[model samples]
Target: MPEIGAPHKVTHQDGGNDEISLTGLSGLAGESQTPLAHKTSHQDGGTDEISVGGLAGRQIFVPYNAKIADINEADTNKHTLNLETALSETRKIIALIAMTSRVSGSSVFWVYPNEGTTGIDLVATLRYGSTLIIKDATQRLQYSQGFANDDWDLYCFGYVVEI
Candidate 1:
């Protein structure tokens, strides 16, 4: 009887919601020792959705007080990525890659921050070479570009939860 906008299916019972597909998976969760993050429990009725495309590439480890936002250099283009640590509480975006060793077909999207100015409605268009991953139901991955100058070095691994 449902089917309004569709796209909602979460089945669980085997270890119940241990973070491994509730919908949105591009394919990848290769190895695990329990650290995929995205554990929700409702038990009987339903409402336990998990995303970040099933940990994309896997490696969800964040907890050492986490406070490291980086971009090595060369942000040439219509650049827009600034996160020198601004997640004092919402942590779980495992890892956002692209350190640029050789591949430079750069492309990234997702933005929401204004005061220093930033916002024109553009979201989630990542997934390029050099393994760009994001997991643990994701937290925040602020970025924006349109490909004009081409030069990047991004890094936004996360962990800052205590509440």
Candidate 2:
């Protein structure tokens, strides 16, 4: 009978045992050499760094929201949404939610990573309230609608890494 919230010694059938604690678990293969810890320093006024699960980096998420009204109906041209005003630096897009007002008669929306006619299409669909998990890095995004007079709302949750 082991105590709750205490380190328990786990025995293996092969006559091996390892101590597992409530805070952390061991016995995993190819684990990181660095221990899980958080350090704060005020000498140089730097950000805090945390090492968890064998990964070390500064974890920061910035919420981004942009709304475009009356997107010039569905045309052959694409509209650009500049994120410089919302986010100062270029960030990795972790997750993005694209929402559009309800429209009738088969409407589709496309989100691109670059401007102009040539670039990778990040999203393309006719459904509203769609979520996309992307790893593309950029400061701006381009969008186009299938129907005329459709409003688009973009919500982005991005992660910024400090060099």
- Which is the leading candidate under lDDT? 2
Candidate 1 C-alpha lDDT tens digits along 112-133: 3331245333223323322333
- By TM-score, the best candidate is 2
Candidate 2 structure quality by residue, lDDT tens digits, 9-113: 333322335422334545553344555443334222344434344554434555545443334455635766655544455544444455544334355556653
TM-score of every prediction relative to native? 0.20, 0.39
CA shift at 163, candidate 2, in angstroms?
7.2
How many collisions per candidate?
0, 1
Which pairs clash in the backbone of model 2?
Answer: 73-148
